[model samples]
Target: MNTRSGLFAVAVGALTALGLACGGAESVDELPPEPPENEVNFPALVQGVVNGWTINTSEEFPPIGCGAGSLINQMRCVGGNCDDVGAYCASAGATFSDTYWTSYFSEEGTNYRTCSAGWWMTGLVCRGAHCDDISIQCTQVTNRGTGSCRWADRQFSEEFPNTYSLPSGWYARGLACTGGLCDNLRVYECQLL
Candidate 1:
């Protein structure tokens, strides 16, 4: 071969020897690629809560007698199906005619209940308050629709973050949730106040 061909052959030989000396490792291009980020598979939430209320009560005054109901509770439910709660409140002298039913949504299910202690405003001392600033966040997989996923008097829930004093109270009227977030909470003060 000519001088150039000889040189080319020597260079090729040197490259092969260098590769062997370097453990013959493949370049980075041969490695597997990295997985993507923020890839959500099932239903989930990055922040905030489901469609519901917080029901805040100050340290001074909190709920005493609490009544819960829904579409399918242990006994009573929504829309005039509160015989259980009604009996409990009546036994405690809390008039059902003057009370208000509070409904809130959650990841588990929708909550339906009556607040009499601080909310009924039945001439009794304000036992507590219902603030809609509940900060509950979560993500899960379910067969629920993308909307509010809320049913009527069919889903019953107890409660959480027990920040109250009494269980039952007198009664009141006209209180509801405006569907707001934690920061933009809705406070239903005692009607007497």
Candidate 2:
């Protein structure tokens, strides 16, 4: 068949499958087959000693994303803080990761004999709205310490308290967002490990 016919066939198949799954009046045979069970216990979620966690964020505009909202979450984290945040958000329990790192930069390294610590991070990440809604929220899902992230848009140029600095002996991490409305991922919580 030509391209149009091929496309039509694919479209019909997808709709048929969707209809069958979504309360559609379809026979049992129309449903997709399930895979055979493979009983295997997955590894437990546990935290361990590491350098620290790092949460990378995106700077998308308009209908911002990343936050655990209506849209698919875009934020992911690494390190101990990642585990804690995941648990906190899921409330299932604390999970752990081993991804710690540090960064040093600039003239400060020469003048003060020290460079900027990678742990120091700041940004007003807004999703739906802008900086006007200066509300930063970090919710704990599980005792194990997993975190769910969120944020908004950017309006004012002034620096809000949208920043975080892990303690001297701590390794914290969190998600980030963009837009200029309400920061999607603001580090509202930090833990010492």
Candidate 3:
């Protein structure tokens, strides 16, 4: 009878231990505080840049066409330079020119080849007030046949060692500087074009 009572006590103790282990002492009041009001919206904070590939595959270089010889044979180039056989040629050329080529290379299957003969405008923002000249470099990998623009970390200037406020109604579009004053400030006043 004493042994039976001991066994019952042990079972109750085990159950109590299990219950305490499962139900921790945490309360609802211990949660983290809410975020501040002035913070930027989550969508805007993680918004993708519009400057990436605006276009992809074109009619001339249909997706999955194989190349022939020096010219873009059968296969349609997708992403790079159109001039380069292995780059993304679809979005590298001008919209009008790409459209023309799309019509010109109108073929059915994986038998015909499209050739890029003229100069395709490399979608590179040139060094100017509207571009960060310091962050200017060309990527070796041609999309179709042209090299893509990349940001090279060649420091152009380090003159003013302080936070300079942008002019009223002007946001930083681009930044370029040489020796002394970091003057070239490309400002965009919410103009979309």
Candidate 4:
């Protein structure tokens, strides 16, 4: 009887050990999965509208009125001022209205121009129409013109106050375009010639 009791005690201890091992394995497997990394959280409306457009650390252009009927027009930053202006008549569906064009910097020597109508905005300089709709190649203009002759993407973000340090994998450079003109990656500083 004593031997039988001893045998029963041994069996009970083995069973308890088995139970504890199985319970530990189950607990480990039941742990929740880790959350995804590098998630971007933004509102639905902003994400939808800004999708595919260039994301830069600069103010968006306001619309402006041009032509006789005050037609709402689109303009691109060409040179000088933090927000310079140039006629942007691309059939590629670019458009701007008066809400897009506004004074960017208050520095006295900065310049801004509109290509659709020749106009320059220099501090204390008489505001007058100095450009025309003729698609003047900024490269040909010897005097520093308000409009940048560079490509759109290059000129829009690089000039003066809009300048920003590029990310690690990105390089700031220039690309030559039609008529031997080069546009800077930051469009605002794009110069003719």
- On lDDT, the leading prediction is 2
Which lDDT tens digits does candidate 3 get at residues 95-183? 22221111111111211111122222122111222121111111112233322211122322122211233222211111223321222
TM-score for each of the candidates: 0.16, 0.20, 0.16, 0.16
Error of 4 at 160 (Å): 24
lDDT tens per residue, model 4, 1-193: 5885676556545734643111111122122211111221211111111112122112233222222111111223334232233332211122222111111111111222222212211111111121111111111122323333222342332243333332222211111111111122222222211
* lDDT leaderboard ranking: 2, 4, 1, 3
Per-residue lDDT for 1-193 in model 2, tens only? 8886676557546644643211111223222222111321212222221222223321222112122211111123232222111112211122322211111111111100100111111111221212222111222222232222112222111244223433332222322323323222333223322
After superposing candidate 1 on the true structure, give the runs of residues whose Cα lies further than 4 Å from its correct spot: 1-93, 97-181
Q: Give Cα-based local distance difference scores for all models.
A: 0.21, 0.23, 0.21, 0.22
- Kindly list the per-residue Cα lDDT of model 1 for residues 134-189, writing each as its tens digit: 11111111221121111121222123211112212212211112222111111122
Ranking, TM-score, top scorer first: 2, 4, 1, 3
What's the number of clashes in each of the models?
A: 18, 45, 22, 24
C-alpha RMSD values across all candidates: 27.1, 19.1, 27.0, 27.5
TM-score of 4: 0.16
RMSD of 1: 27.1
Over the full model, what C-alpha lDDT does candidate 3 score relative to the true structure?
A: 0.21
